[model samples]
Target: MPTISMTVNGKSVSGEAEGRTLLVSFLREELGLTGTHVGCDTSQCGACIVHVDGQSVKACTMFAAEAEGAQVTTIEGMANPDGSLGVIQQAFQDNHGLQCGFCTPGMVMTAADLLKNNPNPSEKEVREYLEGNLCRCTGYHNIVKSILAAAATMRGEQVAAE
Candidate 1:
């Protein structure tokens, strides 16, 4: 086993892992950040998405060793410093963006990345950007609404009543 270290959730962390250990495993088992789900063993599901050096990546597709010295942000880190829900998260809650909740983490993470790059994404753009993240529940209607509302909120504009 090799010791892998990274800055996770703005904190330093290190743990021993086999070279083949997936980053999601290290984050879940070693660091106990289970918010990053593992709905699929393959990369088809975005359930295990996380931010690696500020870009969203599928954690299950990358090895723990590859994340050495990287800055990783899991779903658990998406909240405010005082632990309140962040803008995107609040939007999800307010908009009923989640049903079973299996895909909410990845959806939120992806939304964060999208909003980072494009602060005010149109409904079509939001839908297009979320193609990689599949949500079996809610039919994606509320999820898209959530992201758009989050974008509006992040831009400091008033969110119209739905």
Candidate 2:
């Protein structure tokens, strides 16, 4: 095993990893950040999505060693400093964006990335952005609504109008 260090969730963390270790395993197994799920062993499912140096990447696709000295933000890090749910998360809850909860982390991570790039995405754009994430539950209606609502709220507009 080799030592790897990275800044995760605003904290400095170090761990041991084999050359073949994936970032997802390091986060969940070594660092105990289980919020980053492994819904699909393949990278097709975005359940293991995380922000790597401020850009979203599927953790299963990246080796742990590749993340050396990088900044990683998991779902656990998406909260306010005081530990309350962040605006996007709150929007998901308010709009009923989750059922079974298996896909919420991925959906939320993708939504965060989309909102980061486009503050006010159209409904079509929202639907398109979510194409990579498969939610067996909710049929994606409320997830789309939640993303739109979160975008409106992030833009300081009244969420009710959206």
How high is each candidate's TM-score?
Answer: 0.98, 0.96
- Tell how far residue 21 is off in model 1, in angstroms: 0.2
Candidate 1 global CA lDDT score = 0.94
Mind sharing the TM-score for model 2? 0.96
Quantify how close model 1 is to the true structure by its C-alpha RMSD in Å: 0.7
lDDT of 2 by residue, 1-162 (tens): 789999998999999999999999999999999999998878887889999998888999999999999999999999999999999899999999998888898889999999999998999999998888888889999999999999988999986633
Model 1, 1-162: lDDT tens per residue? 789899999999999899899999999999999999998878987999999999999999999999999999999999999999999999999999999999999999999999999998999999998988988989999999999999999999998766
Error of 2 at 34 (Å): 0.2
| TM-score (C-alpha) between model 1 and the true structure | 0.98
In model 1, residue pairs whose N, Cα or C atoms come closer than 3 Å (at least 3 residues apart or on different chains), thus clashing, are: none
RMSD to truth, every model: 0.7, 1.3
lDDT of 1 at 21: 96
Whole-model Cα lDDT of every candidate shown, in order: 0.94, 0.92
